[model samples]
Target chain A: MNLLTDLIFDYTLRNIALGAAVLGIVSGMLGSFAVLRRQGLLGDTLAHAALPGICIAYLLTGSKSPLVLFLGAAISGWVATLVLLRIVRETRIKEDSALGVVLSVFFGVGIMLLTFILKHNDANQAGLDKFLFGQAATVTAEDVNTMTILGVFALLVVAVLYKEFKIMTFDPNFAASLGFNDRWLGVILTSLIVVAVVIGLRTVGVVLMSAMLVGPAVAARQWTNRLEAMVLLAGFFGALSGVAGALISVSEANLPTGPMVILSLTVIVIISLLFAPQRGILWDIKRFSKA
Target chain B: MEIVITGILISVACALLGTFLILRKMAMMSDAISHAILPGLVAGYFFAKGPDLFAGFLGALVAALVTVTLVEALKNTQRVGGESAIGIVFPAMFALGTFLVARFFENVHLDTDAVLFGNIEFVAFDRLFIGDVDFGPQSYYVAGALCLINLLFITVFYKELKLATFDAGLAATLGFSPFFIHYALMALVSVTSVGAFTSVGAVLVVALMIVPAAAAYLLTDKLPMMIGLAAGIGALSAVLGYGLALAIDSSVAGAIVSVAGAFFFAAMLFSPSHGLIAKARRIERQRVQIGLEALLVHLLNHEGEEGEAHESEMLHLSSELRWLPQFAQQIVGVAANRGLVMQLHGHLILTDNGRRQGQQLMVH
Candidate 1:
């Protein structure tokens, strides 16, 4: 009871919890679309590509505003996708190879820019390094508010275009045949992924955001075959992990919030993998043995 | 000197493992485990009685196994795809490592930045001191041993790796466990990643692993030659990337990755068999031959027509056939030069041999 009161009363802890939960839920929903389409690696590419955008955003705006940073990240991540798609379309380089090129080259550029900024503009770059490995413990209410706004906007977009996205993800050619304009839908989906990744940047960092995108979707996939159920379950699992991570990390100051959240997600994934009925690993094993 | 030696050793180790990685379509797994080994490194450091090679190796092994096991577990569940499993496991591990660093190991000498983008220039300073004697940089010995182990493994399991990579089903039928081979290869890759990462950082280790082997793959079909060429390319890129870092005074790993990318681009453009240029040229030649054949066929059909010589009236042929005027003229000029057609008062007449050729094409 005392712990509950402390948790409810503590403003920073509450904000952190809210931010992480919102991040988890939104990324979980968006990542389901990515994971189902077999474009899980795209999330990783978007996360890395966003770094240069974040740096460029900071350089251009000279402000630490999360929204501005996020916009910058979105644009760069989108461009990286375009470049990646173009390379794959125009050349003999396979998709995996193209992914590799875009991921490393863009990250290299981002690192160069970051080191450059650190060298030349040392004073203003104090919080910038935190973006590499997130500092979720320092999240404020305003940051949470920003994440909520973005999350809601993303959810609204996904809601409005849900059917088109569903068809396109499952069968792009069929979607095109049905006059859904699959290419533009692909852009929209990629945009959503970029937004979710950018939004998760402050909480999970670039390197670890892909896990947040993949973990919940993967966990939810074990529980259900239907997309809707999986999305909802992913959101539920993600939020649960987020809240638990936030609470646990706050309770023990020695644990970092971002890692705790991811670790919590990992635990959920393990449990879901082993125990989810029907499609669960153990269930399959038992069925095989019985048969 | 020591930095270069360390770089070459790491390069050879990565490139050797990379050939199989690229072949098995598991290049990104190497990337994932390289980053995922962070938590292992931290635990290794925390528990080690002394900072030694075995500690890093043990931590790396545990981390690699955890990564491989988690990925395999996810795969077995059928819920996560292979790429997605890799995507999930590494970040979780990396995040845990970061948290471990921030929480309990704050005062420890574990620098995350150093782990990500190593200071290759400083490799000479970290000398290995065995009580009374100093034997240059510790990275050389570390990377060298890893290289030897990788070379030995490849030599011993060459046939198994080849069979499993190219055709796992066939290997399985032959009584070889493809699953066992996979685990073994991943273990070697994990150990190699740890060795290479110590000198070049984990981020650039994947680049070192993939680019050389992929470039060689594009350049050749022979397995042994591919390995040899990949090693050569790796060595060249390491040297050039090192020189580039020296010139720009920037991160050596970044420069190395950039140089490897350049090599890939070069191979993509210039490799005779599989390069983009070669493909384009092949396509261009096929298009020209196809157009010429169509032109010849059209000429033969109109050879004895009563009026409106669609094949002879060059402008009409260009318009009716939807060919550019330039292309039409080029095809016509070639046909004339090859004695396939004769121009007479804006009418095309096929020679005897041209008629035979056109008849052959029509018959076929």
Candidate 2:
């Protein structure tokens, strides 16, 4: 008990937990759009694409400011997204293929660059390699503040454009006919997603970031049909998983916080996907039996 | 140039797999299998105690089969769709694999990066020799053999596969078991996925397996044509993308995928029967016809409400509804030339035959 109390008070532990909490909220909010748009894989692709941006930022600035790195990451992410869209538009490739292609190419380049940097540049390139698998323990107060501001900005954008987003996603042609500027709306939503992914990269890394984005929203979707409720519940689940995973990792020195957090979100999604009311597996089974 | 050759070989293999996956509506299963095989890979490494590629392949095959069997069982027993079952099982398995890796293999350089991203640059390092002449790249042989085998299998059993894909119930009634074919296809997908994992990685493999097939689907309705087109597109994209990537110093897989996307979009917008442009034109034509019909109906309703004989309007009409203003005007001009409607003091009047035709139009 004393050990647990002592661990909670540790600065690193607090920083990790707070940073994770902020990321969870951000991922949860943006993940709702991802799930609704049926672009759940987008987050994963964008996260992988962020790696090149971090490396570039480090190379250019020689400073490890989270803000600069994140901005660079966001730009790269948007570029990846644009490439994906271009591929889908200009070629005979399917959307999933485009996503996979963009994700791998960017990530592969990032890996190569990172290796080069490690060999040639400063050996103490602090916190950059951690972006691959993520090191939540290294998150600082500055990260928390940045994440909080971004999270608030993302949430405000979602709130202001909720109806437009709903119309555009559900019936894009009709929204276009109604002169809603659906193209612009899509751009805005995608940008927000890119930003959210960039911010969360510090906490979750490229590999498991998609899980954070998809898992909570998937879980929340099982419990409700209303978009608002699902988004709220998703946010709650995200925050809960983040905090719980952080606590677990802090309590146990061997466990990595990113994967633990991802696992927690995965568990929640599995539970909801299997046993939740209405859209759950059990519910589907019951309906099938009745039919 | 080496990357280009490797890309082409990989694309052909993926194109072959993509055909079946697209036909079966199991495109996303490739993605799930790619991720689910992680635990098997880790276990294989442990047993071999090193980077044993063959062991990894065997382990991945086992993992994929288990995944397919479990997903199938869940679907049968619980009535869950393929996607949902996939959603539940693969992630859990993946998490377990990740956990195990972190716990045991953290110090051994065994990580998700190697599994998910793969190291294509090292493909040349692993050489497969054919009796003194070294086969340029080892993976080329493996992937090439698999592709050839897949092509042969598909061709030999084309009739059975086609019948099953299009109408499973009919195939079952005809004494061909779709269940066997389904499992066979799944097994093939699993094997190919494992083989391809080393070259293209997990994520890009999914693209290779689905995009080309989907693009082919947009261009044709016939299965044979679709398969051929898919292979062609896949190969073309691979070459183009690899070249582009080399020139730009970017990712080969990304360029290839983008090229595939470009093809699909073009097909979606330009295809004759179902393309966006054709559909839009059809809608426009339909709206014009509907508007004309509504206008005629409205004029007819007004005539009936007035309780008038409507002799003048009736006389000017032909089998076409001439009471509607636009139709009336058009018909009058045509009738005058044909000597059916005669004009008196700017008022249109019909001859005996014209009046008969007008009455016929109303009755019909």
The interface RMSD values of the models, given in order, are: 2.1, 5.4
Supply the TM-score for candidate 2: 0.71
lDDT of each residue in B210-252, candidate 1, tens digit only = 8888888889999998898888888887788778767766667
Candidate 1: pairs in clash: none
- RMSD of every prediction: 2.9, 8.1
lDDT per residue for candidate 2 within A89-135, as digits (tens), equals: 75445566566556655765675566557666766785677766678
Please give the TM-score that candidate 1 achieves against the real structure.
0.91
How well does candidate 1 score on lDDT at residue A288? Answer: 92
**Shift in Å, residue B58, candidate 2:** 2.5
Task: Assess candidate 2 and give its lDDT.
Answer: 0.74
Best by the DockQ measure: 1
